[model samples]
Target: MIDQILEEIRRYETIIIHRHVRPDPDALGSQGGLASLIRDNFPGKRVYIVGEETEDLRFLVRMDEIADSAYAGALVIVCDTANQERVSDSRYSCGARIIKIDHHPLVDSYGEPQWVETSASSTSEMITSIYRNHPELVLTGQAARLLFAGIVGDTGRFQFSNVTEETFLSAAELMKKPFDRQKFFDTLYQRKLAVVRLNGYVLQHFTLTDEGVGFIKLPLDLIHSFHLQSSDASTLVNCFSTTEGLKAWVLFSEEEGLIRARIRSKGPEINQLAARYHGGGHPLASGATVYSWDEADGLIADLKVLCSRT
Candidate 1:
């Protein structure tokens, strides 16, 4: 797979990298890392990283805006995205050849050459694997650092169950490059007082059902009170994890006319439940969006039942 991907890179003179919408660290990292890798090794190739930025991840890398004509003969490399609808740019389809590199479960196979490694901790890890196998492709310090950030971010600092021995090996390889690991952590975790207070509110108002399903529902007013976007508050679902006597937890924040949910579980396949609510992701970490509070409650009820069964 690495050989084939490398061959595709050699064939294209112009390369455009993309990831999922509302880019996460893994998404941005893999996109940026691959772009850097390609540029470092193949200096003649024109590389561009295109994506919609997230406030939390803007510090990592800058996104590029290219003319639509640039994609006419370009090679598009998409990372960390499961489905085409979630792709950040619609121009990806304009490329002469499309390469889909992802760690998500196969949702839709949009690219001619698709590499999906669901067992990999993150898409960044998979990219690191490619670098490991193909030493001919120069891996710069900046690219390694970006890949390291992606691996750490997706694995929850190696706390998530997805972290395998290969994850650590890949991380160790990236760490070989001289970068400030402490500084990266500091930037990744830096939060404002408002976010701290918001977390306190979430913990204080969190609900626990009889079936051990912990949940917090943040209404539009509460979200506005914190001066936070729904996606910002949804990230607080991590606070519900590691608590005693809780099988699964979800954070629901009002987004526009819908309620966006971020779901986490100590154990159990909750992505199936999220699928019913118009969203799906990894087994333990998944998301959903519902039209009404009643629908959110119904989804919560289903989760409670799932917990009881487990």
Candidate 2:
């Protein structure tokens, strides 16, 4: 499938990389690695990346250089994205031809050639597979670092249950490169003192519905009180959901005059509940936007029904 994807890549003179909205390390990493791969192998071709703004993910390098004009006659390779609606750029639909390389299941197939690997740990792992079979292709340091970071971040330093033998092999390949492992971990784990304290504040407000659904709410005012960035407020939605015994967790924070929610589940398809309020994502993790805290509370009540059903 990768070789076929590569064959398709060589057909286009211009390429644009894309990923899901509110980009994570995996999404940005795959975009970076793939762009580097193409630019290295096809020197005459033009490659660009597109998606939502994730300044933190710029650690991967060159991910910030994409221009929207690249959409013309471009083969857009979308990474780490599941649902089409959740993709960062609607302009992707306007691409001459689209190719999707993702580790998430298909919600819809917009591309002529789509690669979705449900069992893969991350999209970066798939990109590693691409480079593995063809090592003749140059592995730029920027690309290598992006792939490494995605593998580590999505695997939670290989601590998550999703870490498979394949994940280890992909990681082992990356470790062969000369990179500072300690500094990488520090970059990911280290948080501002205020950001660290805010986690404590969110944890303090946590409540579990009778059905074993855990939730934390951070009002917009509270976000203001802490002088937290919207990204910081948005980042805490999944921390509690990933706990050992919890069936589900919800993080509700206000941003730009709307309540943005991040929901996660261990044993249930909480996305159905998220869809009820005009938002969606993977079954285990999803999001919704609501007008007020009251609406968010109603969504929470609906989510409890899902938890109870599970």
Candidate 3:
């Protein structure tokens, strides 16, 4: 599979990489690492990684390498994105050929020549597997750090149930390069006081089902009253996971502009619940959005019905 992907890589002169919108470190890291690998190995080829704004990952090795103009004939390599609707940029398909390498479950939008492994812990893990067989690709220290960050973030530091032996093996392989493991762990796990307090509020006010699925809905007024920024609510569901006897949890936060929802599960699949709202993700972890708080609440009720059966 790696050889086939590398052969696909060699077929194009220009390659543009993409990932999911509202990218976390893993999404940016895979795109940046792969783009750097291509640029370093295929020195003459033009490689670009395009996506929506990345959080705390703007300082990547080749962050400034993307070109403003579309390539006349390009191979757009999409990573981490599960569904085409969630793709960060719409311009990717303007290319001549499309190759998708994702860890998300197969969705209808991904074209043929798709390489997806739903069992993989993270997209970053898949990227590492791709480069493992292609040692000729110069994986630099900075690029390695970016990849490491992604793998750790997506795996929840190898603590999530999605983690597998391959996940650790790929992470160990990545540690070969001169990456700052300590700083990477700190940046991802460390939280501020406001963030901690925000999480406290969510867990304290959360409602749980008899079957162990938990839900927390925070309105915009309450979010503002706590002075919690969107960054603080980034992983609000993480707090609920620590609640005793929790098999799954969801966080619905109302922002001024949009209604956002995040779902995390350990004992049952919840992606179908997310899919009902025009969103998709891995079975254990998924998310969706609604236009208003009322709609999001209705969706939460719908998810509760599904969880009751699980």
Candidate 4:
């Protein structure tokens, strides 16, 4: 699959990279890392990263805005995204060829050359694996740094269950290039006073089900009270993740008249549950959006049942 991806890259003079909407570190890292790899190995090719700007990741490389004409003969490589609707940009379809490189479970196969390795820790890990297989492809220091950030971010700083021996090996390979790992952590973990206070609010107000499922519902008013973006509020789901006696945790934040949920589990596969509620992701981590609080409560009830079984 990596060979086929390389062949496609060689065939196209313009390469455009994309990721999921509301980009996470893994998404940005993999997209930027791959773009850097392509640019370094094939300097003549035009490589661009296109996506919605993420305020949290503004410290990293900025996204590019390419002209529509550029996609006429471009090769689009999407990273860390499972479905077409989640893609940051629809212009990807304008490309001459498309390659889907992801770690998510297969949903809709949008590209001709699809490489979905669900076992990989992150899409960044998948990109590193490709470089490992094809050593001739130049792995620049910037690319290595971006890929390392992606791997570490998705694996929860090497604490998640998905951290395999291969994950460490790939990380070690990327570490061959000199980058300030400490500085990266400093930037990633840095939080403003507002964020810290918001976390306190979440911890103080979280509810626990009889079956040990922890959850919190943040309405738009509460979100505004904390001056938090819906995405930022959704990240607070992790605040309940490590609580003792809890089998799973979820955060439901109201956005644009709908409730968006971020779900996490210490046991049981919740992605299938998320899929039933209009969202799907990894076994332990997933997301969904619902039309009403009742629907969100239904998801929580289902999670409670799942926790009881475990």
Candidate 5:
């Protein structure tokens, strides 16, 4: 699969890379890291990484504004995204050929020569493996930083169950590069004062069920009251994760008239539940959407039952 993907990369002149929406570090890391790899190895090729930029993560990499014409005869590669619906840009289909590079369980298979490694820690790790296998490919300091950030973000700073020997080996390899690791960690975790305050509020108000299921429902007004955006509120999902008897948790934050569900678990598989609610991701960590407060309650109820069974 790596050989096939490398061959495709060699064939294209213009390449556009994409990832899932609501950009997280892993999504941005893989998309940008792959773009960096291509740009460094194939200097003559034009590479553009496209996606909606998140304010907090913009320090890692910025999106490129290319015209529709740029997608003409381009090779589009989507990173870290499981399904087409979650892909940030609709323009992904405009490419002449498409490839998928992801670490999530296959949800929707859309790309040709798709590479899905569910056991891999992150798409960034998979991207790093590409450089490891192909000696001709160069790993720049910037690429190393991006890939490392992605691995850290998805693995919960290497605290999650996903980390394997390959994950550590990949990290060891990336650390050899000359990027400022301290600055990357500082900048990646620097949160606003308002967001800190909101975390306190979540710790106070989040609901914990007897079934070992915990949840937080942050409506739009409640988020604005904290002087933070919905994205800021979403980060607080893990704030109360250490609570005793907590088997699984979900943070439902209202955004643009819909509730975005960021689901995490300690014991139960939750991605199938996410899939039923217009989302999907790793079993332990996933995302979903709910249209109304009642529907959100339904999701919570479902999660509670799931935890009860576990």
Candidate 6:
């Protein structure tokens, strides 16, 4: 798969990289990491990473502003995205060809030579394998930093069950580069005062069901009261994850007329449940959307049932 993707890379002079919307570390990491690999090894190739920017994660990497004409004969490669609808840039289809490199379970297949490795920990790890297989490819410090950040973010600092021998091996390999690990950790975890206060509110208000199902609903008004955006609430999903008897958890943060559900589990397969509600992801982690508060309650009820059975 790496050789096939490398072949495509070699074929295209103009390459654009993309990832999922509501960009996370792995999304930007793999997108930027792969771009760096291509740029360094194939210096003449025009590589660009495009996506809507997030304030908190801008330090890791930034997006490029390319004209539509750039995609006239470009090769678009999407990383860390499971579904086509969730892809960040609509212009991905403007390219002549599309490739998918992701670690999530297949949700909607679109690209040719789709490389979806559900067991690969994170897409950044998969990107690292490219350099491992082909030593001639230059692994720059910037690429190593981006890929390391992605792996750490997706694996919860190597604490999540997703981490495996290959994950550590990839990290070890990337560590051979010269990026500052301490500075990266410090910058990646830096939070604002508003987010810190909201964390207190969540700790005080989140509910845990007797069936080991934990959930928290953050209304738009409540999030606004904290002077934060709906996306900011996503960082708090795992805040109460360590609660005793917790089998599964859901964090619902309201947006304009709809609520986004970030679901996590230790026992139940929640991606199928997420798919039923307009979302899909890994077995232990997933996301969905609800149109109303009542619908949000319905999701909680379903999660409780799932936990009870587990």
lDDT of 5 by residue, 46-123 (tens): 999998998899999999999999999999999998889889989999999999999899878889999999999999
TM-score, one value per model = 0.98, 0.90, 0.91, 0.97, 0.98, 0.99
Total backbone collisions, model 5: 0
- Which numbered prediction scores highest in TM-score against the true structure? 6
Q: In candidate 3, which residue pairs get closer than 3 Å at backbone N, Cα or C atoms, i.e. clash?
A: none
Compose the digit string of candidate 4's lDDT tens values, residues 1-310: 8888888888889999999998888999999999999999998999999989978788767999889998987889999999999999899889888889999989788888889999999999999998999887889888998999999889989999999999999999999988888898899878767778889999899998779899999898888888887777855679767777888989999988789999998878999999999999999999998999999889999998898998
Winner by lDDT: 6
Q: How well is each residue in 206-270 modelled by candidate 3, as lDDT tens digits? A: 98877687888877788878787655586667876877777777888777788778888886788
- On a 0 to 100 scale, what is the lDDT of residue 197 in model 4? 87
Clash pairs (backbone) in predicted model 6: none
Q: What is the lDDT of candidate 4?
A: 0.90
lDDT value for model 1: 0.90
Clashes of each: 0, 0, 0, 0, 0, 0
Question: Candidate 2: minimum summed lDDT over ten consecutive residues — where?
Answer: 57-66
lDDT, residue 219, candidate 1: 93
Using TM-score as the measure, name the better of candidate 3 and candidate 6: 6
User: Which pairs of residues have clashing backbones in candidate 1?
Assistant: none
Give the per-residue lDDT of model 2 (tens digit) for 24-134: 788888888788878877899988877666565554554445556767787777888877887787877777988888876566777868888878889999999998888
| Full-model lDDT, candidate 6 | 0.94
The models' CA-based lDDT, in order, is 0.90, 0.79, 0.78, 0.90, 0.93, 0.94
Model 5 ranges off by over 4 Å: none
Give the candidates in order of lDDT, highest first: 6, 5, 1, 4, 2, 3
